[model samples]
Target: MQLRQMTDPNLILFDVEAESKEQVIKQLVSKLAKEDYLESEQPFLEAVLQREEVSPTGMERGLAIPHGKSTAVKKAAFAVARLKTPLEDWESIDPTNKVQLVFLIAIPTNEGGSTHLEVLSTLSTNLMRDGYMEGLMATNSKEEFLSRLDIEEKVKSNSDKKYDKTVVAITACATGIAHTYMAAEALEKAGHELGVNVLVEKQGANGIEDELTPSVIEKADAVIFATDIAPKQKERFAGKSYVQTRVAEPLRQAKEMIQKALSNPDGVVEENDSEEASQSSSSSNGSGGFLKDAVQAVMTGISYMIPVIVAAGLMMGIAKLGAMPFGLVNELHEAKYATHSNELFVILHHLDKFGVLIFKFMYPIFAAFVAYSLADRVGLVAGFIGGAFAGGLHHTFWGIEGIPSGFLGALILGLAAGYISRFLNQKIQLSKNFQAMKPMFLIPAISVLSTFFLNFYVIDPVFGGLNVVLRNWIESAQGTGDVVLASIIASATAFDLGGPINKAAGAIAIGLAADQVYPLTARVLAIVIPPIGLGLATVIDKYVVGRRVFEADLRVAGNTALLLGFIAISEGAIPFMLRNPLITIPINIIGAIVGASTAVLLGAVQWLPLPAFWGWPLVDNLWAYLLGLVVGASFIAFANIFIRFAMIKKRELAA
Candidate 1:
């Protein structure tokens, strides 16, 4: 089918008002769905975003080509949107351009074989032609615009021009869709202008094109390695002078990069292990490809947040355990703290209070780092602001004294801040003298304000309402029976290991405990059970199956998990969940539920922050608590082992 067959007038939106690139994509994707171009919008949207994480599609002269391959798309199509406000932080190869136009292409993940390459190639070539984009901008009607998509020849270089220097270049990208060709065309165009003979070997999804022979490499004076990943056969240029950069760098600086390669940039070609060094230099030298994935950004945030969680929990645990001997600890009967005249009690009370203070900023820290991951230092201030809102810092302003949104809130705000700050940094055009104001003043102020607006109108209200509903349910659940309450809390805690859902459960349970709704017995035990259980399973797997069931590294993780579990850190079990999430998650939930329910039925009560062994003395029924813990952990351990053994036996029988 022709390019225009994929685009309907209904899919072409004009004068769309959106502040960010994400909003624009969603708006267009929604339109595509309304026009029956997609079976579902979210999966396709996610695919497009995944492509974005690999490398931003924004190009020079106010254009962005964001495409995705997904089963959610019923048909391959292109949608165009002309935005009223230029999206600044779209991460266009040319950082200076504010993206006013977007070409969002949807390719069916399963059916996008050659059709995918054809669409991307046609669009990329049409864009490369002289005045193609400018012509589209002048079109007032959708039909006028659609007609522009007709087949067109690529902008040609002067073939008759003579050159003294010959540069052989390689262009590659993670997707190998649009960028590979775009970079090649840019290099050729630059060579034509500079009177240098440039031959490009494209390493793409379709494999290498215009393959470089030994003769070409031998004759060339310099080489340009423009790629996101390591180029194939890089050793061919080991002894030759080379310049390394990312794929998109050529879009804006093709001439400068070609010139630099001719100069033989230092540190790229070292004496020892020169090929490896050159490859490493090429990867590191590029400013792009640093933002790996959204999940990685979240994990990075979680990693940074983990130490804070552990420290706050440990401090609170110590204070609770220390105050127990002197009868200074608060119980259901006593609403007072451990602020007794004894110096130790007073010190412990102060420490407990300090822990609460530290816990308050946990969400904000999680958010700030996540933003830092996505948008670098520019996202820090905005992320911190968003996280503070997520943490319910404006409780007085909102007039709601309940639990904060916790991890979920932090994640949302962190990502939002990163996108906003990054966008403003890229979009806002400033002159040389005032450019310093962009990052130091303009970006932070605007991003923070935008984040505040989002939380004020949306996040706080929604989460606060959810909190109210959750609190009422907890009170109602406790009225009927402790079993119901314990099961629910324990299940939620074990659900995602250390994900936002776990934090959400923690927020509600801890808030209720503070208000004396129910003891923390279920919450604390549930937190420890999964890690301990997973650890035990790892230890017994080989014995149960007469062969190693898990990888060697998992066994090491098992040892660490066992120790961490005893100390009430649920994050230690995260490795197991990540490896086999579908089975592991359900098993963990069941184990936690059984353990917490058993503890409740046996009258094991603990309302304090002490989740570790040190707090056993403070528990109302220590024997019942111990039995429940063992029963839950053992159930999880044995169940996991049995399932693994069955799988192993089945495989052997089949063999």
Candidate 2:
């Protein structure tokens, strides 16, 4: 179908209002339904939303293209919307850009194979042209909009002129829409300005375009791969000096990157080795060494683990709340409560048990996902098996009884399993006939067996000892006094906010709480203080400090931070901290330390893991806890103000 034929007047909306990506998709779907383009709107809407979630369609320059193919659509069609305001947190490839123009594509399931591709290709190509986008945006009526799409030929640039230095670059992103093209454009412009000939191959949602041939690579002095993810067929650039960076870097500093590439054109080449040796080297040093890879793997696990932790923690808190009034708080975990005459008590008791069961899987999930991040599905099974073994699964190796190894052991097992699986994946190759079984059976079966033996013999013993030392140290700190222990935990929790260090401290606190050590109170304080402190700083900067230190975007974020802080989400402070990390991060850590120390000194105790404001009543010294929070937040606010003023004065002096 032609562009105009699919884009009817009824399917085009002007100045549409939507607060979120989902809402925008729904609105566009509703418009398509009004034109009788869909057999069912809800299914089509869901399909579109699912597609958007897989990788946001939001591109640079205030544009978004959300499309789906489903049986719910009776005909292939297009729905367009010009948003009155931009959609924030829409996962644009360029984070700085908010989506203002949306194109929604709906295709019949049967028609998607080729018809859909053709239409999408046409639209995507037209969208990339500046004159076409400008003309479309300037259109006042549906007819005018349709007429703008009638361009016979795409725009061409005369800057294709030859230059002395030739370079080839690839620009890609996870979403492969906005940042890919934006980086390509930026590099091209920068190359022209610097009298360098640059040809950029864009790997975008529409697929690879302007592919770099072997001749081009041979002719180019150097190459650049600006991507968030590793580009497909990366070995193609082997032996060529290449500069790697996040896609957005080129958009901001293309000239500097080009200069660096020119100066040092010889990049590190992958070594030729036996498959086994290659895998070993890759696991140890290929991706910036084992330490960096381990950190990244652990962070990936934590990102997935947080949701489960939050859900289970909330359920356990609610269960405690229900049992507290009946004087059954301690009995909530007892088996006798399962048969209690009071139905509510029994239900709460079961919920508490269920929460505990889920909590038990926390380490296993963390370990499994870490391996999965490194070695995909095969590593998942291996990691889970290793983690389970570490989590007190009975095992007899060389007649030595193994004990529960805990979180630290799980961390080691995860890394070991990931490397083992990655090695097997790279080194092993089956006959073509059995290739399918390799992924489904051979890889998983071998990886699991190998990881299990390694963990049982090597990783478990080493990390298990380390885990014991860690636990003993924590116990010793607790015995010395609450202040020291609380300070340490608080510092770790605030140091990286929701990052690896923060999650490690939080995980330890959860483990300690399971043993009835009562460090959750300090953890709860650490969780709330950073976000609240940052939010309070923004308010103080606006009203009390007698100036608006924060920009409009930051002022908006302050409100979100306050809301999230009340619910004990420390990650809400990340955006604010990123702006002035040197100032903001130190103040946040200090605030957390002060708050945690004061809470512990005042004997604040929490029986529930809930971080909500309503959980205040669960604390032993509620007023003291509140006082600690206020004092810590006050310090953060004043420190932020002072830092901002100092920065401003420095800028003035420099000027």
Candidate 3:
């Protein structure tokens, strides 16, 4: 449908008097509601505001396209307005440009397919034309404005020129918002100027638009992938000569990149090689490039593994509660198992066993997904086999008996499995008829077999031995006044929130619990302190620094942190940490150390692996645990408040 068809005369507002962007949006939404285009205003307004937070839609030449897709929208519609006064401080790519023309678009939230995207693309393209925008702005009335929108002008093509290159490109960004479409536009404009035929596909918030067909890809002279993350179905570009770079690069230097691609076609690396190098090069400036990638892979695994952990942990906690009626709590804690004459107790014991069964596979799932992220589907079997082997699934592989390799070994084997599968994928290419069987049989058989032997003979022995040594050291530190060890565990657990290091500490704690180490006081405190501390920081900020500094989203985040913190999810603090890592991270670490050390010194004991507030009743020396949380959270609150006040003062002085 045409852009003009989506709007009505009643939806158009002339000489709109709005002082701020919020007022402008509210006015437009009110109009939309009045016109029966929106069923509810609040939800639609919230969705639009949330989108604005990610990146503002204010474009160049006094234009702003504020849009939202939600169930609150009764129909796809547009509301146009001409502001009587320009609003300052609205986020725009060009800060000097004050927006005068507003186009508010409302789309159905559940609308399947790329209908909204098509409309957006068309509207954005037309807005780029100086004549089209000027004509619309010149309209004196709603009918005139609608008439101006109906006057479509044909875009002259430069296809008559004899250009040798036919380029196909894909553009994507992390959020798949403004930059994705902007890059596509830039590249297309550049292609037109250069008299080269270019087909640009946009992978944006709505999904892929103008997707490249196999025939188009096969006929293209070169491919350009502009993305911050790896493109989906990346294997499609496997054999094609391609230029890969960050999404923003095209917006900045599209002509230069295109020229370079045309000139040096042979220089374009294979898809896998380019991706690996891209990942490496992006982090090359830092010494921790490999470490960051490894952490990212593990964190990907952790995010997927969390639901399993929570479910199993809660089940075990309930089982403990069930055993209490039979007076078998202490016995179950000691023996890690119990039998009772009561049928209810028997069922609880079975539930505990079932939870344990699911829990044991956590690391394996972690390993498999980590590999999948790295090498896609081919890595699944290999990663799972490697992780299972690490978990001591086949202790006597080839008559070489070994211990369970634990999390450390799982980490190593997971990466190895991914790389192994990646290597196989790169090397092997079957005929078309046999290609379908490769992923199902050939790749899995070879990758799993290789990973199995490697883990059993090499990785397991080395990491398994180191794992034993580390556990013994930690065990030895227990009951001793080993402040250093306690502090280290606490710091590591809080360092990355729920990233690799935190997960590593958690894995160790869980392992120890399985081994009949009833009281993992320090580790449990570490898990709870960071999130609680950060939540306290937000509360303190509201009182000391004022709510204006928190913004709408940060306030929402702060509220979320409190609930998540109570549930022992340290990841709740990640947004705060990311905002001011220098200040927030150090404060979190200090709070974690204080809480963990206090818990250990006070002899707080926790039998269950569950970390939620509901499990507090199961802790030994419960008062001490609560006291540690209060003390550490207080430290975080005070420190955070002071730091924020100082920063705000500094900014004011600079202003």
Candidate 4:
């Protein structure tokens, strides 16, 4: 939970003889591996590589923290190395962007608790000192190097003196990597140099690392998030300093950004001018550039919306089953009741009767949050209007009453609210007296009014047209009832396993889930299969190459991956990819596509999204689903064996 707790003195390598940056990384990682600081070098190396791919670890002012989450890391660890010669790496706020001091942090992928944050925060605060990094780099002895950080003071939380300065910050980027950490460090360093103790946090693929403790955060003058990724626990900085920006500006114009944040606590920054901002925004959105914000916004919305979705979805599932046992539908429905008897239905029935209303309205709540992330204050009203419109439209189309669009309507509605609110804000003017009323009254009122009318009139007709077109297309595809198209989609869906093709399939599945036509199980499986099945492939052929992954590290990754796979977690694949992407990716693709295709042909029903219900098996046909899993897993295993053999042969040739 503290920085020193994770730092091993033995892993601290100073005055090393490494010719290249890669050599430095390998030496440190190999040492960690040999010392059992990590489970193995391959996973740690892979994590480092993966992190590199996302964003370079090099920071401004000659510091870099290249960190990753891995099952290879048995315990959280800090591998500190001060380069004897300056080594080149990706950097933020660096024209050359080379690295000298490298801190490779290895954390267990499962340590999702505060441990990750603690390490990140500790490093940020300590390294923010202007002399701190130089001191470490200057030290020839390992003892002096670790001592430079004053690691002991960090361990004794009570000994630290709290400096109160309003330190504004930002965290944003395309990959959400190097710049995120660098900008935070720059700001923290600015505070430190200015005699202000600053606490900075970063948001990245690995999650929020180095979060300033609440005590530290509360005592701070203010906080700034220069990030495209949504800052975790935003409400924590409510009363104090808070601001948002694109990643680049904080690094490019560090002092200016900090000064601006200090000046305006509630002010919002659009770093449209910075190259980092433009590049990042472009990468995140692509052709549908507007959608770049959409993914993060929706993800944040969904994350917040999960508790509601789970509560409501499960309640309804229970209620439906309960109604069946009570003869609410028919005794024939009892056949489906093989999985659950009257006893289970009894619990479900109560939930349905008492909790349906709350669950039923979950979509609207979800939409509201999504809208809020986009258009801020005005989005709340517009989001609700959009959700209501979608629900009403569904009712009108099917000649049914009270059917909620759930996440689908929420998604569409949130987007609609965002656009509408943004447009309205541009058109409207705020009077001095009515300033307080902007977020509270004017923005919401106009946005809601505009979105409601548009969705009811314009959006409904569009939905009807699309729905008809889709139904017809599906029927045409299934003309002979062979489900060939569905099978093809399934195959394609699983082909690449988190690659471009895989993502495309996932998008399509998510779209179907929104439409209520595709079962929740299919979508969940699509998400789960790549990570899980790849894990399975690794487990099945742990000794495929004999020397590559046939060890304790592979076993650890395999077992952890299996657990994550059953739960439909994508993180499970990370371990295998770190060890061997060449083998793992291809194997994952085969399994994912085969399983998906078979499930499509078999028509397995997925009732809930990945969050609430995953890996239950047999909603449509448990045996059929199980069969698909076997086919998929086997395909990947065989492919991996071939790839691993080739890799071994290549290594032998080199040797």
Candidate 5:
């Protein structure tokens, strides 16, 4: 009913003395075990470690909220520990702050989802004000600390009464500690102001712990799910009032979703049905949808793209490996693994060509599926029309001395198909028999016709004109590099996990792959380097710059994703940025731009159009890729060091 109702004072440790954040965390967790707050220290600690491996929880204002929702928690509990000395956590770039303040919140996923938002909102808002952290640090007794918390809670609770409608929400960042908690607080504050009963369920690396349980779901008017990672167990809210969004948006948009849901309490929008439709379409076509749809589409797309990218990337790699001896053409006859110019070699070459052919198969499929996710059956036809038209446009524009507008064309087509399908779905009607036929006849026919004409007359010509402008711009861009451009692009890439900026870059690479003109390996390497570099930098600088709480997260992020990065995967870096954007993005951007600029300047040409793989050398200049790697890696490492030092300095000033 109230914050203290859930918090056990026995679990709270004030003026807790520990040398570092990790030692303090372990001490606090072990203490929780002693107090019977957790079933055992090991499971709870392991969850903390495991989750942190994926994401660090070091938040703004020299605080570390390391939490987990796992089997380890015997009861929902909160503990506070004030370190005698700051601890080194992996994700903490500001070395000065080390984690002096640590809050270890434990909850069982099954009991209720962890109320991470409540804890974070309670803590973050208190920590944010000028003297609140100093007040916290100055407190010498549990009574003093409790008093501070009580005061903060009173103010927050009063704010909660302002909302006219009450809403419960679940907020999760991949790691579950900092951002999950912060977003939770944000939503709560908004709910309070709007007079809503806001509850948040949190899922973090620690596993699912104390949260708004099934009862909460059953009682609440609606639920808001803000997460970047896949939720562990989602069956509880099957038909409940709910909506999903990224973790950060809730502070601003969640209140609105709650308002809408409350206004029409019985009219909650469930994405599951639409998600399934798009996934089915993805299996047949390529991929499509908003976050859920896109995720499914991407999964399907990757499944389809893998064979082609592998065969092509490897063959091209082999060819590059043998480039000198074969003198390009003659080497086709030389056989190392298999006889070249022999049936085996010819067959392999044919497979390589087939792989390239399959690579082409992905574009239309991807475009169509994307449309399908947005507009269902009608979207597919429109998407196909758009993709096919884009292909033709590429040939006409770039191949005809007009410069490539393939990326622009594909985007337009996908959007066009989605809108067309949406329009038909809204305006078109049919009888029962016609409804069945509608998908086959009405949706496809009109969609295709609309897509074709739209692409032919409007999309093509618009991009055609834009291509001329873009080409001139690119030409002028030579020797005109600016730091602002680099910063803006890099920051945008790091701002959201797999959001628009990520897609834009990915779309460009995909366009290059489709053209068969530019090399795929080069583009993928550039894409892959950012996450890898930042991850490594987090690892390398962990000891000096991060708190122990963050080290757990960095270990997960740095280690779990490193292998994936070697073969050119970008998703691996998502957790790092998801938890701490302000700190993570700058470091990631520095790494990405360093890699991209270096690769571009070195003329690191890719012979094959494929995703990243290490067994084969896909690029014409392997060293250039390595150069990008080094530049990216070094930039982040240095950034971590410098940033951490600045944090240390700031803390000293405050102290």
Candidate 6:
């Protein structure tokens, strides 16, 4: 495995000329072919090009390493080039880098795993040493250059280097070939130079190498996630002080990243220390930065809330259905006053109470996660207290029960708790010994008190006042414009799919249902209709139109949309909406309006804040709800298919 045995001088070129990235690659790949190391030049060339598409192989200091793993390679070999003119057009990890030296490595598919490790351990190690690359460029002859590489000292000076601290790291890139190993080597060397033991795990093409054990992770002082994708088993480093960055950053700034991790080994990641967690994929449709982060937190809250909503809704629905056969639907709707004598009926009554109790935690879990996103674990206590008050946790005074603002209370209080805790952590000056007090004691106290005051004085009064005004207006107006109100709210819910309008629509719907001024019939119907309708259109496209209306990729996306629709995430329809905003958005809005208004006018009353089929039994008139839902969804599905097909036909005729 000596570097000298791997190649001959004929493979190394000097004073090379290239105008583009492709030209340079072609020149190098031609050498591998001429040397009979490759079975096919074109196939291997395509392999290298496909690797480049994932992420460029360029590094700082005017160096690029383009590599490929293919069966077309007869042997594992490499070619080097010292360019006369820099390849300015080459895409690089560091955008400012213009390639002056290129190393092209070819590995046979059979020996890919073993050879890649050997190539990286020997070649990448030498490249990390100071003046190693400069020495390569300075050599006048190929024989002299080969001598310089071999004659260089091989013994490690860091063998005697003692370490007191340990930093665990995970390095991964898009291809998990070049940049991944380079970053790991760079961190290990830098850690050695700094007198620290940096244990690294490489998640690469060869699979997990030097995997860190739980024992080692527990003993480590800090963590570094150098990855382009989310690192596997990230929960292992949950409480550790950490830094997260792209895979290639360590090739240049390895020491700096390590030092920051060492200094803050007992706290949440500071804003100045590293970049924020990669944006949540759910928030891709929103405005970026703070707004995106806010939406991400909300989505996280929503994700946790789903199980609670589904379980509670399903249990309640089952209880209601079971009681219908015995003429005890009213008695078993709530367990508070169950008059049933039979053991079977008694169990159903208990299930009804359990479901009602479980529903109370839905908003709390939502708020807790939202707070976790903003302020980490310290924000949970305040989130629960605020959420309980927001959902009206039954503390009565003067014959009035708890004043519940529902989602509005949870949203406001959760955000407040997160920001306040984050601010306190950053602003409060603390000695080294007192750092533990910030997350455990100080943060929870201040956050909970703030939540109590905000909920009691401000949020409660406003929502309570609105509820009184709405109750009066609803009773006086009776059925006047009931469908109009439903139409407006439902339309807004699907107006932009998962954008701001769509997100805020939930709160508005919940607000209307707080005091039963209007039932949640419209809101729940609107939630599932658009995504399910759009999803159905794609599935039945060929059947109805005698040809596939959507492309191959979109057909797959439609199946995903259909699955997500049952879980009531409107984001499933986001792709369709994005593809034809004018067509899809308006149609979605109209569909939601029709579904909501129809459900409302038909007397399908739903007082609870739940969505999807699990909530169907909770509706006062189940048949009416189903009928309205079918009518509205069918309109959207058929309308979308015919309009898009006609448009396609017109384009075909013109062609």
- The candidate that achieves the highest lDDT relative to the unseen native structure: 1
Q: Backbone clashes in each candidate structure, one number apiece? A: 3, 1, 0, 18, 48, 0
> Which digits, one per residue and each the tens of the lDDT, describe model 5 over residues 145-231?
766664445535464344344466666664455566667767766676576878767675455645667677766766666765434
Task: State the lDDT of candidate 6 residue by residue for 1-655, as single tens digits.
Answer: 5666667899999999888777888999999999999999999999998765444567656888888899999988888889998876565545457789888889999887798567755565566667878888899999877776643432334466667999999998655666777798789878877878998999876788889998998899898878764455554664567766668789869999899778843243442211222111111121243554565456556545656755665676577668767766556655554565577888788887887787778767878877766666666788777777766663532356544666656787877877776676556655756666666677789989999889879988887675555445434543567887777667766775543344455565677689666777877778788888888888787568755566433455566566656646555565465346679878888888887777777888888865656557778988888877887778789989999989977865764
lDDT of 3: 0.69
Q: Return the clash pairs for model 1, or none.
A: 70-109, 88-427, 89-423
**Candidate 2 residues 1-655, lDDT tens each?**
3588777777888888887777888888888887788888899988887675344466667777789999999888888998888876565544445778888889998877666666655665555555777787788998888877666631126545668998789997655655677788778778877988888998876678789997888788778877654454444554556676667788669998898778853244342222222211134322454555565566556545545555555667678777766766656889888998889988999898886666556667867877875665657888887667655554533456544555555677887788887777666766666556655777788888887687767766665565455555555676666788888778767766655456556677888888987558777888888888877877666345434555433555565566667756565565455345667778888988898788778878875776657678878889888888887777877787777866755764764
TM-score of 6: 0.46
Global lDDT of each model? 0.74, 0.70, 0.69, 0.56, 0.56, 0.71
RMSD of 3: 7.9
lDDT of 1 by residue, 161-247 (tens): 678999999998656767888888889778877978889999887788789998998899888878765466665654566776668
How many clashing residue pairs are found in candidate 2?
1
Model 6: how far is 311 from its true place, Å?
A: 2.8
Give candidate 2 misplaced runs (Cα > 4 Å). 1-7, 10-58, 64-91, 96-132, 138-141, 149-331, 376-378, 389-411, 424-591, 598-615, 618-621, 630-655
Candidate 1 contains a number of clashing pairs equal to 3
The C-alpha TM-scores of every prediction are 0.46, 0.53, 0.66, 0.49, 0.45, 0.46
Give me candidate 2's TM-score against the actual structure. Answer: 0.53
**Order of the predicted models by lDDT, top scorer first:** 1, 6, 2, 3, 4, 5
Clashing pairs in 3: none
C-alpha positional error of residue 312 in candidate 2 after TM-score superposition, expressed in Å: 3.7
lDDT of 4 by residue, 332-411 (tens): 23434444665665455455545446544555666776776665555667886676565454465558743233234456
The superposed Cα distance between candidate 4 and the true structure at residue 259, in angstroms, equals: 11
